[model samples]
Target: MRVGLYPGTFDPITIGHIDIIRRATALVDRLVIGVAINRDKGPMFSLEERVAMLEAEIAPLQQETGVEIVAHPFENLLIDCAHDVGAGLIIRGLRAVADFEYEYQMVGMNRALDSSVETVFLMADLKHQAIASKLVKEIARLGGDVSKFVTPAVCDALYKRLGR
Candidate 1:
């Protein structure tokens, strides 16, 4: 089976993220959405919350695409996580040239760590290209609506967390 890993902080999975997940699942038999728990970044959502949100958000697509999808909470080395999950490819979403520059270096490092695993980049859909988790949270914190950027469930979670 060709398994792919799409890893991200996903403090609150956005529309842009769902777009990437949809595209990635079509390319591989199994696509694992690896939620990275990086405390240094101070994510708005807890690891458990993020995983639950992702699982709920992707459930419909999983059924629609007939693609095996799972939420994995991971820490430590990303390459090691890919190896652990038996992933042959790592799926990444690129929104702009700046994203490619950072992802390019990370891809090189990941390749060095595990040459057997390949990396694939999928461009974000035009509508969601400007959406990002950080910006979404910022907008919500300031009482701005983020419904366009995220799902209704995520919007509720943001409100619950931000005490809106």
Candidate 2:
């Protein structure tokens, strides 16, 4: 089976992420959503919460696309995580040219670590291109409406987390 790993913090799993995950299903039989446990970023949601959010958001997509989707949490290197998930392909979502520069370096480093694994970039839908998790959290924290950027469930979670 063709398995792909899509790694991210997924603090709240924005619509942009959903768009990528939905599109990524077409490329792999099994899509592993790697929820990174990066303590350095000080994410708004815990690893468990992030994983749960991802699971909730992708459930319908999995059903719709008939692609097995699993949420896997990893604190190790992304390349190592891909190996652990048996992913020969690493899927990444690109929002802009700035994202490509960083992803380019990452792809190079990951290739050096494991030449067998390949990285594929999927550009975000134009509507969601500007929707980032960080910005979503910022808007939510400031009492702004985030319904357009996230699912109703995620929006509710963000508000509940922020005590709004």
Residue pairs clashing in model 2 are none
Alpha-carbon local distance difference test for all models: 0.94, 0.95
Q: What TM-score does model 1 achieve against the real structure?
A: 0.98
**Model 2 bad stretches (over 4 Å):** none
List model 2 lDDT by residue over 20-131, tens digit each. 9999999999999999999999999999999998998899998899999999999999999999999999999999999999999999999999999999999999999899
Write model 1 residue lDDT over 1-164, tens digit each, in one string: 99999999998999999999999988999999999999999998889999999999999999999999999999979999998899999999999999999999999999898899999999999998899999999999999999999999999999999888
lDDT of 1 at 75: 95
Error of 1 at 16 (Å): 0.6
TM-score for each predicted model, relative to the true structure: 0.98, 0.99
